[model samples]
Target: KILSYLDDSGSGRVDLGMFYAVVAPLCGGHLDKRKRVAFEALLWRPVNEGGSSQITKMDAVKYIKLLRAIYIPSQGMSEMLEVHGEADDDTSSSMVTFNQFLGMYDDSEWGFGIMSTVVKLETRDRNRHGNQVCSVCRYPIIGSRFKEVKTGFSLCNQCYSEGKVPPTFKQQEEYKFREYGSEVEAMKAKCVCFSMQSHKNPIAT
Candidate 1:
Protein backbone atom coordinates (compact mmCIF):
# COMPACT_ATOMS: atom_id res chain seq x y z
CA LYS A 1 0.00 0.00 0.00
CA ILE A 2 1.68 3.22 1.28
CA LEU A 3 5.02 1.42 1.55
CA SER A 4 4.77 0.27 -2.06
CA TYR A 5 4.09 3.83 -3.15
CA LEU A 6 6.97 5.32 -1.11
CA ASP A 7 9.47 2.46 -1.59
CA ASP A 8 10.41 3.78 -5.10
CA SER A 9 13.03 1.07 -5.57
CA GLY A 10 10.60 -1.87 -5.49
CA SER A 11 12.56 -3.34 -2.58
CA GLY A 12 9.92 -2.91 0.17
CA ARG A 13 12.09 -0.25 1.89
CA VAL A 14 12.28 3.55 1.59
CA ASP A 15 15.83 4.64 0.75
CA LEU A 16 17.54 8.00 1.31
CA GLY A 17 16.13 9.88 -1.68
CA MET A 18 12.63 8.52 -1.20
CA PHE A 19 12.84 9.26 2.49
CA TYR A 20 13.89 12.89 1.91
CA ALA A 21 11.14 13.48 -0.62
CA VAL A 22 8.56 12.30 1.91
CA VAL A 23 9.87 14.15 4.95
CA ALA A 24 11.08 17.50 3.60
CA PRO A 25 7.70 19.18 3.34
CA LEU A 26 6.44 18.00 6.70
CA CYS A 27 9.53 18.80 8.77
CA GLY A 28 9.12 22.45 7.64
CA GLY A 29 12.35 21.98 5.61
CA HIS A 30 15.49 19.82 5.62
CA LEU A 31 16.26 17.71 8.67
CA ASP A 32 19.03 18.96 10.93
CA LYS A 33 21.55 16.71 12.77
CA ARG A 34 19.50 16.25 15.92
CA LYS A 35 16.30 15.77 13.92
CA ARG A 36 17.96 13.18 11.66
CA VAL A 37 19.27 11.21 14.66
CA ALA A 38 15.84 11.24 16.27
CA PHE A 39 14.20 10.22 13.00
CA GLU A 40 16.54 7.25 12.56
CA ALA A 41 15.88 6.04 16.09
CA LEU A 42 12.13 6.28 15.67
CA LEU A 43 11.90 4.39 12.35
CA TRP A 44 14.74 1.94 13.00
CA ARG A 45 13.55 -1.65 13.28
CA PRO A 46 15.89 -4.43 14.46
CA VAL A 47 18.56 -5.29 11.86
CA ASN A 48 18.18 -8.95 12.76
CA GLU A 49 14.61 -8.76 11.50
CA GLY A 50 15.60 -7.19 8.17
CA GLY A 51 15.67 -3.64 9.53
CA SER A 52 18.29 -0.92 9.20
CA SER A 53 18.69 2.85 9.11
CA GLN A 54 16.55 2.63 6.01
CA ILE A 55 12.96 2.22 7.10
CA THR A 56 10.88 -0.74 5.97
CA LYS A 57 7.36 -0.20 4.66
CA MET A 58 5.80 -1.69 7.81
CA ASP A 59 7.83 0.55 10.10
CA ALA A 60 7.11 3.61 7.97
CA VAL A 61 3.41 2.91 8.04
CA LYS A 62 3.44 2.53 11.81
CA TYR A 63 5.34 5.78 12.14
CA ILE A 64 2.84 7.62 9.96
CA LYS A 65 -0.07 6.21 11.97
CA LEU A 66 1.48 7.54 15.16
CA LEU A 67 1.94 10.95 13.55
CA ARG A 68 -1.72 11.11 12.57
CA ALA A 69 -2.66 10.27 16.14
CA ILE A 70 -0.96 13.43 17.42
CA TYR A 71 -4.09 15.51 18.15
CA ILE A 72 -2.78 18.41 20.24
CA PRO A 73 -4.62 21.55 19.19
CA SER A 74 -2.65 23.96 16.92
CA GLN A 75 0.43 21.80 17.36
CA GLY A 76 0.29 18.23 16.11
CA MET A 77 -1.89 16.58 13.44
CA SER A 78 -3.64 19.85 12.67
CA GLU A 79 -0.43 21.59 11.61
CA MET A 80 1.02 18.53 9.86
CA LEU A 81 -2.19 17.92 7.94
CA GLU A 82 -1.94 21.38 6.48
CA VAL A 83 1.54 20.51 5.24
CA HIS A 84 0.36 17.17 3.92
CA GLY A 85 -2.41 18.73 1.83
CA GLU A 86 0.09 20.97 0.05
CA ALA A 87 2.62 18.22 -0.73
CA ASP A 88 2.58 16.17 -3.94
CA ASP A 89 -0.03 13.42 -3.81
CA ASP A 90 2.38 10.64 -4.87
CA THR A 91 4.75 11.01 -1.86
CA SER A 92 2.54 12.16 0.99
CA SER A 93 -0.71 10.25 0.39
CA SER A 94 -1.71 10.45 4.09
CA MET A 95 1.81 9.55 5.27
CA VAL A 96 4.75 11.58 6.48
CA THR A 97 8.46 10.70 6.33
CA PHE A 98 10.78 10.08 9.27
CA ASN A 99 11.83 13.70 9.82
CA GLN A 100 8.26 14.87 9.37
CA PHE A 101 7.18 12.42 12.04
CA LEU A 102 9.91 13.69 14.36
CA GLY A 103 8.90 17.28 13.63
CA MET A 104 5.37 16.57 14.76
CA TYR A 105 6.67 14.96 17.94
CA ASP A 106 8.87 17.98 18.63
CA ASP A 107 5.89 20.30 18.18
CA SER A 108 4.07 18.22 20.80
CA GLU A 109 6.80 19.08 23.33
CA TRP A 110 4.47 21.75 24.69
CA GLY A 111 2.72 18.86 26.45
CA PHE A 112 6.06 18.09 28.07
CA GLY A 113 6.40 21.75 29.03
CA ILE A 114 3.01 21.44 30.75
CA MET A 115 4.25 18.33 32.54
CA SER A 116 7.33 20.24 33.71
CA THR A 117 4.96 22.97 34.93
CA VAL A 118 3.07 20.31 36.91
CA VAL A 119 6.30 19.30 38.63
CA LYS A 120 6.95 22.89 39.59
CA LEU A 121 3.39 23.17 40.89
CA GLU A 122 3.88 20.02 42.97
CA THR A 123 7.08 21.43 44.47
CA ARG A 124 5.27 24.65 45.34
CA ASP A 125 2.34 22.74 46.90
CA ARG A 126 4.71 20.59 48.95
CA ASN A 127 6.43 23.69 50.27
CA ARG A 128 3.17 25.53 50.98
CA HIS A 129 1.33 24.92 54.27
CA GLY A 130 -1.15 26.65 56.51
CA ASN A 131 0.39 28.83 59.27
CA GLN A 132 3.81 28.66 57.66
CA VAL A 133 6.24 31.34 58.89
CA CYS A 134 8.49 33.34 56.56
CA SER A 135 11.98 31.85 56.77
CA VAL A 136 13.57 35.28 56.11
CA CYS A 137 11.56 37.71 58.25
CA ARG A 138 10.41 35.11 60.85
CA TYR A 139 6.90 36.58 60.74
CA PRO A 140 3.69 34.56 60.53
CA ILE A 141 1.86 34.47 57.16
CA ILE A 142 -1.50 35.99 58.09
CA GLY A 143 -4.30 38.40 57.13
CA SER A 144 -3.68 40.31 53.90
CA ARG A 145 0.02 39.54 54.32
CA PHE A 146 1.34 36.89 51.91
CA LYS A 147 4.61 34.99 51.52
CA GLU A 148 6.91 35.61 48.56
CA VAL A 149 9.46 33.06 47.45
CA LYS A 150 13.14 34.02 47.65
CA THR A 151 16.33 32.10 46.93
CA GLY A 152 15.20 28.74 48.31
CA PHE A 153 13.43 30.65 51.10
CA SER A 154 10.20 32.53 51.90
CA LEU A 155 9.72 36.22 52.71
CA CYS A 156 6.93 37.86 54.68
CA ASN A 157 4.77 40.54 53.05
CA GLN A 158 6.62 43.41 54.75
CA CYS A 159 10.00 41.99 53.79
CA TYR A 160 8.88 41.42 50.20
CA SER A 161 7.40 44.93 49.94
CA GLU A 162 10.70 46.33 51.24
CA GLY A 163 12.67 44.52 48.48
CA LYS A 164 14.36 42.19 50.93
CA VAL A 165 14.03 39.21 48.57
CA PRO A 166 16.76 38.35 46.08
CA PRO A 167 16.42 38.84 42.30
CA THR A 168 16.30 35.08 41.57
CA PHE A 169 12.82 34.73 43.01
CA LYS A 170 10.86 35.39 39.82
CA GLN A 171 8.14 32.73 39.97
CA GLN A 172 4.69 33.73 41.15
CA GLU A 173 1.26 32.09 41.26
CA GLU A 174 -2.34 33.15 41.83
CA TYR A 175 -2.59 33.20 45.62
CA LYS A 176 -5.77 33.63 47.63
CA PHE A 177 -4.84 36.33 50.15
CA ARG A 178 -7.04 38.92 51.79
CA GLU A 179 -6.77 42.57 50.73
CA TYR A 180 -6.88 45.55 53.14
CA GLY A 181 -8.42 48.93 52.29
CA SER A 182 -5.92 50.51 54.66
CA GLU A 183 -3.10 49.59 52.22
CA VAL A 184 -4.57 51.90 49.56
CA GLU A 185 -2.99 55.03 51.08
CA ALA A 186 0.37 53.27 51.40
CA MET A 187 0.17 52.04 47.79
CA LYS A 188 -0.75 55.54 46.54
CA ALA A 189 2.20 57.01 48.43
CA LYS A 190 4.57 54.52 46.82
CA CYS A 191 3.15 55.33 43.38
CA VAL A 192 3.63 59.09 43.99
CA CYS A 193 7.27 58.54 44.94
CA PHE A 194 7.86 56.43 41.83
CA SER A 195 6.28 59.16 39.68
CA MET A 196 8.42 61.86 41.26
CA GLN A 197 11.63 59.81 40.73
CA SER A 198 10.70 59.18 37.06
CA HIS A 199 10.11 62.91 36.47
CA LYS A 200 13.39 63.97 38.12
CA ASN A 201 15.69 61.59 36.18
CA PRO A 202 15.18 61.35 32.45
CA ILE A 203 16.76 58.19 31.06
CA ALA A 204 19.68 58.80 28.65
CA THR A 205 18.87 57.74 25.13
Candidate 2:
Protein backbone atom coordinates (compact mmCIF):
# COMPACT_ATOMS: atom_id res chain seq x y z
CA LYS A 1 0.00 0.00 0.00
CA ILE A 2 2.83 2.40 0.74
CA LEU A 3 4.36 1.56 -2.64
CA SER A 4 1.07 2.42 -4.28
CA TYR A 5 1.33 5.94 -2.88
CA LEU A 6 4.56 6.38 -4.84
CA ASP A 7 2.42 6.40 -8.01
CA ASP A 8 1.76 10.10 -7.54
CA SER A 9 4.65 10.90 -9.91
CA GLY A 10 4.23 7.78 -12.06
CA SER A 11 8.01 7.80 -11.76
CA GLY A 12 8.40 5.26 -8.98
CA ARG A 13 9.12 7.85 -6.32
CA VAL A 14 7.31 9.13 -3.24
CA ASP A 15 7.26 12.72 -2.14
CA LEU A 16 7.55 13.72 1.52
CA GLY A 17 3.81 14.39 1.75
CA MET A 18 2.96 11.02 0.25
CA PHE A 19 5.36 9.16 2.54
CA TYR A 20 3.92 10.96 5.56
CA ALA A 21 0.44 9.99 4.49
CA VAL A 22 1.53 6.39 4.43
CA VAL A 23 3.22 6.50 7.86
CA ALA A 24 0.75 8.79 9.65
CA PRO A 25 -1.39 5.84 10.62
CA LEU A 26 1.58 4.12 12.22
CA CYS A 27 2.30 7.26 14.24
CA GLY A 28 -1.33 7.37 15.48
CA GLY A 29 -1.40 11.17 15.33
CA HIS A 30 0.69 11.27 18.51
CA LEU A 31 3.40 13.39 16.95
CA ASP A 32 3.57 16.99 18.05
CA LYS A 33 3.53 19.88 15.56
CA ARG A 34 7.20 20.57 16.20
CA LYS A 35 7.98 16.94 15.75
CA ARG A 36 6.32 17.06 12.37
CA VAL A 37 8.77 19.79 11.45
CA ALA A 38 11.69 17.71 12.66
CA PHE A 39 10.39 14.89 10.49
CA GLU A 40 10.51 17.19 7.49
CA ALA A 41 14.13 17.81 8.30
CA LEU A 42 14.69 14.10 8.26
CA LEU A 43 12.79 13.66 4.99
CA TRP A 44 14.13 16.61 3.07
CA ARG A 45 16.74 16.10 0.38
CA PRO A 46 18.44 18.84 -1.61
CA VAL A 47 17.11 18.89 -5.14
CA ASN A 48 20.41 20.30 -6.36
CA GLU A 49 22.06 17.14 -5.21
CA GLY A 50 21.81 13.96 -7.25
CA GLY A 51 18.44 13.11 -5.72
CA SER A 52 15.19 14.96 -6.26
CA SER A 53 12.93 16.41 -3.58
CA GLN A 54 10.94 13.17 -3.71
CA ILE A 55 12.06 9.94 -2.09
CA THR A 56 12.94 6.88 -4.10
CA LYS A 57 13.38 3.32 -2.88
CA MET A 58 17.10 3.88 -2.47
CA ASP A 59 16.44 7.13 -0.65
CA ALA A 60 14.10 5.36 1.71
CA VAL A 61 16.87 2.89 2.55
CA LYS A 62 19.21 5.71 3.42
CA TYR A 63 16.55 7.33 5.60
CA ILE A 64 15.86 4.08 7.40
CA LYS A 65 19.56 3.65 8.10
CA LEU A 66 19.77 7.13 9.58
CA LEU A 67 16.62 6.51 11.57
CA ARG A 68 18.06 3.29 12.92
CA ALA A 69 21.16 5.12 14.07
CA ILE A 70 19.15 7.77 15.85
CA TYR A 71 16.77 5.33 17.47
CA ILE A 72 18.66 2.11 18.27
CA PRO A 73 22.29 2.58 17.52
CA SER A 74 23.20 1.30 20.94
CA GLN A 75 21.80 -2.11 20.02
CA GLY A 76 23.16 -3.63 16.85
CA MET A 77 20.50 -4.85 14.43
CA SER A 78 21.87 -8.37 14.47
CA GLU A 79 22.02 -8.43 18.27
CA MET A 80 18.47 -7.21 18.60
CA LEU A 81 17.19 -9.77 16.13
CA GLU A 82 19.07 -12.51 17.93
CA VAL A 83 17.81 -11.48 21.38
CA HIS A 84 14.19 -11.41 20.22
CA GLY A 85 14.43 -14.22 17.69
CA GLU A 86 12.18 -12.20 15.43
CA ALA A 87 13.87 -13.14 12.19
CA ASP A 88 14.36 -16.86 11.87
CA ASP A 89 16.41 -16.78 8.69
CA ASP A 90 19.82 -15.19 8.78
CA THR A 91 19.51 -14.06 5.22
CA SER A 92 16.48 -12.11 4.00
CA SER A 93 15.59 -9.31 1.66
CA SER A 94 16.61 -5.86 2.72
CA MET A 95 13.09 -4.61 2.10
CA VAL A 96 10.65 -5.02 4.99
CA THR A 97 6.95 -5.64 4.52
CA PHE A 98 4.43 -3.59 6.48
CA ASN A 99 3.35 -6.61 8.47
CA GLN A 100 6.98 -7.47 9.19
CA PHE A 101 7.57 -4.01 10.57
CA LEU A 102 4.56 -4.25 12.84
CA GLY A 103 5.48 -7.79 13.84
CA MET A 104 8.87 -6.63 15.03
CA TYR A 105 7.26 -4.64 17.79
CA ASP A 106 4.38 -7.06 18.35
CA ASP A 107 6.75 -9.91 19.20
CA SER A 108 8.37 -8.27 22.20
CA GLU A 109 7.05 -7.53 25.71
CA TRP A 110 8.85 -4.20 25.93
CA GLY A 111 9.21 -3.48 22.22
CA PHE A 112 5.98 -1.50 22.01
CA GLY A 113 6.83 0.34 25.21
CA ILE A 114 10.14 1.56 23.80
CA MET A 115 8.77 2.27 20.33
CA SER A 116 5.85 4.26 21.71
CA THR A 117 8.47 6.59 23.27
CA VAL A 118 6.69 6.66 26.61
CA VAL A 119 8.10 5.15 29.78
CA LYS A 120 5.91 3.47 32.35
CA LEU A 121 6.59 2.57 35.93
CA GLU A 122 8.19 -0.86 36.27
CA THR A 123 7.22 -3.34 38.97
CA ARG A 124 8.91 -3.33 42.37
CA ASP A 125 11.18 -6.03 43.81
CA ARG A 126 12.22 -6.58 47.45
CA ASN A 127 14.15 -9.84 47.76
CA ARG A 128 17.32 -8.50 46.09
CA HIS A 129 19.74 -6.00 47.58
CA GLY A 130 23.41 -4.90 47.93
CA ASN A 131 25.83 -3.07 45.61
CA GLN A 132 22.88 -2.09 43.35
CA VAL A 133 23.14 1.27 41.66
CA CYS A 134 21.05 3.46 39.45
CA SER A 135 21.52 2.37 35.84
CA VAL A 136 21.13 5.91 34.63
CA CYS A 137 23.27 7.86 37.08
CA ARG A 138 25.43 5.02 38.42
CA TYR A 139 25.03 6.11 42.06
CA PRO A 140 24.84 4.08 45.28
CA ILE A 141 21.34 3.16 46.59
CA ILE A 142 21.80 1.56 50.01
CA GLY A 143 21.09 3.45 53.26
CA SER A 144 19.67 6.36 51.34
CA ARG A 145 16.65 7.30 49.34
CA PHE A 146 16.69 4.20 47.14
CA LYS A 147 14.26 2.18 45.09
CA GLU A 148 14.47 -1.06 43.18
CA VAL A 149 12.56 -2.30 40.15
CA LYS A 150 11.75 -5.70 38.74
CA THR A 151 14.90 -5.42 36.65
CA GLY A 152 16.88 -5.95 39.89
CA PHE A 153 18.27 -2.46 39.63
CA SER A 154 18.42 0.28 42.27
CA LEU A 155 18.09 4.05 41.97
CA CYS A 156 18.83 6.74 44.53
CA ASN A 157 16.20 9.16 45.78
CA GLN A 158 18.18 12.19 44.67
CA CYS A 159 18.04 11.11 41.05
CA TYR A 160 14.32 10.34 41.28
CA SER A 161 13.59 13.57 43.11
CA GLU A 162 15.50 15.52 40.49
CA GLY A 163 13.46 13.91 37.73
CA LYS A 164 16.68 12.69 36.12
CA VAL A 165 15.44 9.17 35.71
CA PRO A 166 14.27 8.18 32.26
CA PRO A 167 10.79 6.72 31.98
CA THR A 168 12.11 3.35 30.87
CA PHE A 169 14.04 2.99 34.15
CA LYS A 170 11.61 4.60 36.57
CA GLN A 171 10.09 2.44 39.29
CA GLN A 172 6.36 2.40 39.99
CA GLU A 173 6.95 2.59 43.73
CA GLU A 174 9.66 2.37 46.32
CA TYR A 175 10.11 -0.21 49.05
CA LYS A 176 7.47 0.05 51.79
CA PHE A 177 8.75 1.78 54.90
CA ARG A 178 8.43 0.43 58.46
CA GLU A 179 9.49 1.99 61.76
CA TYR A 180 11.96 -0.18 63.66
CA GLY A 181 14.05 0.89 66.65
CA SER A 182 13.90 4.60 65.85
CA GLU A 183 15.02 3.91 62.28
CA VAL A 184 13.06 3.53 59.09
CA GLU A 185 13.12 0.03 57.62
CA ALA A 186 12.43 -0.70 53.97
CA MET A 187 11.12 -4.09 53.00
CA LYS A 188 11.09 -5.38 49.49
CA ALA A 189 7.49 -5.92 48.36
CA LYS A 190 6.19 -7.79 45.37
CA CYS A 191 4.01 -6.25 42.68
CA VAL A 192 2.50 -7.67 39.52
CA CYS A 193 3.67 -6.52 36.13
CA PHE A 194 1.16 -4.40 34.23
CA SER A 195 0.61 -2.95 30.80
CA MET A 196 2.57 -0.10 29.32
CA GLN A 197 1.24 3.43 29.73
CA SER A 198 -0.17 5.39 26.80
CA HIS A 199 1.59 8.30 25.20
CA LYS A 200 -1.54 10.22 24.22
CA ASN A 201 0.60 13.22 25.02
CA PRO A 202 3.84 12.63 23.09
CA ILE A 203 7.14 14.14 24.05
CA ALA A 204 9.61 15.20 21.38
CA THR A 205 11.56 12.11 20.43
Candidate 3:
Protein backbone atom coordinates (compact mmCIF):
# COMPACT_ATOMS: atom_id res chain seq x y z
CA LYS A 1 0.00 0.00 0.00
CA ILE A 2 2.83 2.35 0.90
CA LEU A 3 4.45 1.65 -2.48
CA SER A 4 1.41 3.21 -4.14
CA TYR A 5 2.16 6.59 -2.56
CA LEU A 6 5.68 6.99 -3.84
CA ASP A 7 5.79 9.90 -6.30
CA ASP A 8 7.91 8.70 -9.19
CA SER A 9 8.52 12.34 -10.19
CA GLY A 10 11.93 13.97 -9.90
CA SER A 11 10.82 16.16 -6.97
CA GLY A 12 12.04 13.47 -4.53
CA ARG A 13 10.09 11.49 -1.86
CA VAL A 14 7.12 13.11 -0.15
CA ASP A 15 7.24 14.01 3.56
CA LEU A 16 5.47 12.24 6.43
CA GLY A 17 2.61 14.75 6.18
CA MET A 18 1.81 13.37 2.75
CA PHE A 19 2.07 9.82 4.08
CA TYR A 20 -0.06 10.73 7.10
CA ALA A 21 -2.89 11.86 4.83
CA VAL A 22 -2.53 8.71 2.77
CA VAL A 23 -2.89 6.41 5.79
CA ALA A 24 -5.38 8.37 7.91
CA PRO A 25 -8.39 6.44 6.71
CA LEU A 26 -6.66 3.06 6.61
CA CYS A 27 -5.57 3.45 10.23
CA GLY A 28 -9.08 4.50 11.27
CA GLY A 29 -7.56 7.28 13.38
CA HIS A 30 -5.77 4.63 15.42
CA LEU A 31 -2.84 4.14 13.10
CA ASP A 32 0.36 3.15 14.77
CA LYS A 33 2.36 6.22 13.89
CA ARG A 34 5.29 4.45 12.25
CA LYS A 35 3.16 2.16 10.08
CA ARG A 36 1.15 5.14 9.03
CA VAL A 37 4.34 6.84 7.98
CA ALA A 38 5.59 3.81 6.04
CA PHE A 39 2.33 3.35 4.19
CA GLU A 40 2.55 6.93 3.03
CA ALA A 41 6.22 6.87 2.09
CA LEU A 42 5.86 3.63 0.14
CA LEU A 43 2.81 4.97 -1.68
CA TRP A 44 4.24 8.39 -2.63
CA ARG A 45 7.84 7.48 -3.42
CA PRO A 46 8.70 7.17 -7.15
CA VAL A 47 11.59 4.77 -6.53
CA ASN A 48 9.83 1.73 -7.93
CA GLU A 49 9.01 3.44 -11.20
CA GLY A 50 12.57 3.21 -12.60
CA GLY A 51 14.57 3.31 -9.43
CA SER A 52 14.98 6.96 -10.49
CA SER A 53 14.00 8.49 -7.13
CA GLN A 54 14.01 5.16 -5.38
CA ILE A 55 13.78 5.28 -1.60
CA THR A 56 15.37 2.37 0.22
CA LYS A 57 13.55 0.38 2.90
CA MET A 58 15.82 2.21 5.34
CA ASP A 59 14.33 5.54 4.31
CA ALA A 60 10.80 4.47 5.20
CA VAL A 61 12.09 3.06 8.48
CA LYS A 62 13.60 6.38 9.49
CA TYR A 63 10.32 8.27 9.05
CA ILE A 64 8.26 5.70 10.90
CA LYS A 65 10.58 5.99 13.90
CA LEU A 66 10.18 9.75 13.79
CA LEU A 67 6.40 9.49 13.86
CA ARG A 68 6.54 7.20 16.85
CA ALA A 69 8.56 9.79 18.72
CA ILE A 70 6.01 12.53 18.00
CA TYR A 71 2.78 10.53 18.13
CA ILE A 72 0.64 11.29 21.20
CA PRO A 73 0.77 8.08 23.23
CA SER A 74 -2.69 6.81 24.00
CA GLN A 75 -4.04 6.49 27.54
CA GLY A 76 -5.28 3.11 26.50
CA MET A 77 -1.67 2.10 25.93
CA SER A 78 -0.81 3.24 29.43
CA GLU A 79 -3.75 1.36 30.91
CA MET A 80 -2.72 -1.74 29.05
CA LEU A 81 0.75 -1.26 30.43
CA GLU A 82 -0.55 -1.03 33.98
CA VAL A 83 -2.69 -4.11 33.55
CA HIS A 84 -0.05 -6.20 31.84
CA GLY A 85 2.71 -5.03 34.17
CA GLU A 86 5.94 -3.43 32.99
CA ALA A 87 8.08 -5.56 30.71
CA ASP A 88 10.66 -5.30 27.95
CA ASP A 89 9.49 -4.72 24.38
CA ASP A 90 10.85 -8.15 23.50
CA THR A 91 8.65 -9.90 26.06
CA SER A 92 5.38 -11.42 24.85
CA SER A 93 2.31 -9.24 25.30
CA SER A 94 -1.28 -9.15 24.16
CA MET A 95 -1.30 -5.41 23.56
CA VAL A 96 2.14 -4.77 22.16
CA THR A 97 3.57 -5.25 18.70
CA PHE A 98 6.68 -4.18 16.81
CA ASN A 99 7.08 -4.02 13.06
CA GLN A 100 9.85 -4.80 10.62
CA PHE A 101 10.55 -1.08 10.58
CA LEU A 102 11.10 -1.18 14.34
CA GLY A 103 7.79 0.54 14.97
CA MET A 104 6.07 -0.53 18.20
CA TYR A 105 2.33 -1.17 18.34
CA ASP A 106 0.22 -0.95 21.47
CA ASP A 107 -1.58 -4.12 20.49
CA SER A 108 1.63 -6.07 20.29
CA GLU A 109 1.79 -9.18 22.48
CA TRP A 110 5.53 -8.75 22.93
CA GLY A 111 6.76 -7.69 26.38
CA PHE A 112 9.91 -6.20 27.82
CA GLY A 113 12.22 -7.50 30.50
CA ILE A 114 11.38 -5.77 33.76
CA MET A 115 13.12 -7.11 36.82
CA SER A 116 11.40 -6.55 40.14
CA THR A 117 12.07 -7.13 43.82
CA VAL A 118 9.64 -8.35 46.48
CA VAL A 119 9.86 -8.64 50.28
CA LYS A 120 7.93 -11.28 52.19
CA LEU A 121 7.21 -12.13 55.86
CA GLU A 122 7.85 -15.79 56.54
CA THR A 123 7.86 -18.23 59.52
CA ARG A 124 9.46 -21.67 59.75
CA ASP A 125 6.98 -24.40 60.67
CA ARG A 126 3.53 -25.56 59.59
CA ASN A 127 2.69 -25.16 63.28
CA ARG A 128 2.94 -21.35 62.98
CA HIS A 129 5.80 -21.21 65.45
CA GLY A 130 7.12 -17.69 64.72
CA ASN A 131 9.84 -18.04 67.37
CA GLN A 132 10.32 -21.77 67.85
CA VAL A 133 13.80 -23.16 67.29
CA CYS A 134 14.04 -26.90 66.74
CA SER A 135 14.76 -28.72 70.03
CA VAL A 136 17.53 -31.08 68.87
CA CYS A 137 19.58 -29.75 65.93
CA ARG A 138 18.52 -26.16 66.63
CA TYR A 139 17.82 -25.65 62.94
CA PRO A 140 16.56 -22.16 62.10
CA ILE A 141 12.78 -22.45 62.21
CA ILE A 142 12.09 -20.36 59.14
CA GLY A 143 10.25 -20.80 55.85
CA SER A 144 13.65 -20.75 54.22
CA ARG A 145 14.72 -23.97 55.95
CA PHE A 146 11.80 -26.47 55.95
CA LYS A 147 13.59 -29.58 54.71
CA GLU A 148 15.77 -29.75 57.79
CA VAL A 149 12.83 -30.19 60.19
CA LYS A 150 13.08 -33.61 61.80
CA THR A 151 10.71 -36.00 63.67
CA GLY A 152 12.46 -36.33 67.05
CA PHE A 153 13.19 -32.75 68.14
CA SER A 154 13.05 -30.60 65.01
CA LEU A 155 16.68 -31.71 64.62
CA CYS A 156 18.70 -31.21 61.45
CA ASN A 157 18.07 -33.98 58.93
CA GLN A 158 21.69 -35.05 59.24
CA CYS A 159 21.44 -35.38 63.04
CA TYR A 160 17.95 -36.91 62.98
CA SER A 161 18.62 -39.76 60.56
CA GLU A 162 21.02 -42.68 60.52
CA GLY A 163 22.97 -41.25 57.56
CA LYS A 164 23.35 -37.75 56.15
CA VAL A 165 22.70 -38.96 52.57
CA PRO A 166 19.34 -39.36 50.84
CA PRO A 167 17.58 -42.68 50.43
CA THR A 168 18.81 -42.84 46.87
CA PHE A 169 21.22 -40.36 45.25
CA LYS A 170 21.00 -42.24 41.94
CA GLN A 171 17.80 -40.55 40.75
CA GLN A 172 18.86 -36.93 41.18
CA GLU A 173 22.00 -34.86 41.34
CA GLU A 174 22.53 -34.70 45.12
CA TYR A 175 21.78 -31.22 46.46
CA LYS A 176 22.20 -29.96 50.00
CA PHE A 177 20.85 -27.09 52.04
CA ARG A 178 23.16 -24.90 54.10
CA GLU A 179 21.24 -25.83 57.19
CA TYR A 180 18.05 -27.86 57.29
CA GLY A 181 14.79 -26.66 58.87
CA SER A 182 12.29 -25.72 56.17
CA GLU A 183 12.32 -25.27 52.42
CA VAL A 184 11.39 -22.09 50.66
CA GLU A 185 9.83 -22.51 47.29
CA ALA A 186 10.42 -20.21 44.37
CA MET A 187 8.67 -16.88 45.00
CA LYS A 188 6.31 -17.25 42.07
CA ALA A 189 5.37 -20.80 42.98
CA LYS A 190 4.94 -19.84 46.62
CA CYS A 191 2.36 -17.24 45.66
CA VAL A 192 -0.02 -20.09 44.89
CA CYS A 193 1.25 -22.90 47.09
CA PHE A 194 1.94 -21.05 50.33
CA SER A 195 -0.85 -19.03 51.89
CA MET A 196 -0.40 -15.66 53.61
CA GLN A 197 -1.81 -15.01 57.08
CA SER A 198 -4.17 -12.20 56.11
CA HIS A 199 -4.64 -13.40 52.57
CA LYS A 200 -4.65 -17.11 53.36
CA ASN A 201 -2.02 -18.65 55.66
CA PRO A 202 1.75 -18.79 55.21
CA ILE A 203 1.86 -22.47 56.08
CA ALA A 204 4.49 -24.99 54.99
CA THR A 205 5.87 -23.97 51.65
Leading candidate by lDDT:
1
**Model 1 — which ten-residue stretch has the worst lDDT?**
174-183
Roughly what TM-score does model 2 have, to 2 decimal places?
Answer: 0.23
Clashes by residue pair, model 1: none
State the lDDT of candidate 1 residue by residue for 12-43, as single tens digits. 66644334433432333233543564456544
- Candidate number that wins on TM-score, 1 or 3: 1
Give the worst 10-residue stretch by lDDT in candidate 2.
119-128
1 against 2, candidate with superior TM-score? 1
Steric clashes per prediction? 0, 1, 43
Model 3's alpha-carbon lDDT is 0.37
> How do the residues 79-153 of candidate 2 rate in per-residue lDDT, one tens digit apiece?
333332233333222433333433433445423224344312111122123445655687545335444434444
lDDT of 1 at 6: 45
In order, what lDDT does every prediction score? 0.44, 0.39, 0.37
Candidate 2: global Cα-lDDT? Answer: 0.39
Candidate 3 residues lying further than 4 Å off, grouped into runs, are 1-18, 21-41, 51-55, 72-205
Winner on lDDT between 2 and 3 is 2
Taking every candidate in turn, the Cα RMSD to the unseen true structure, in Å, is 16.4, 19.0, 20.3
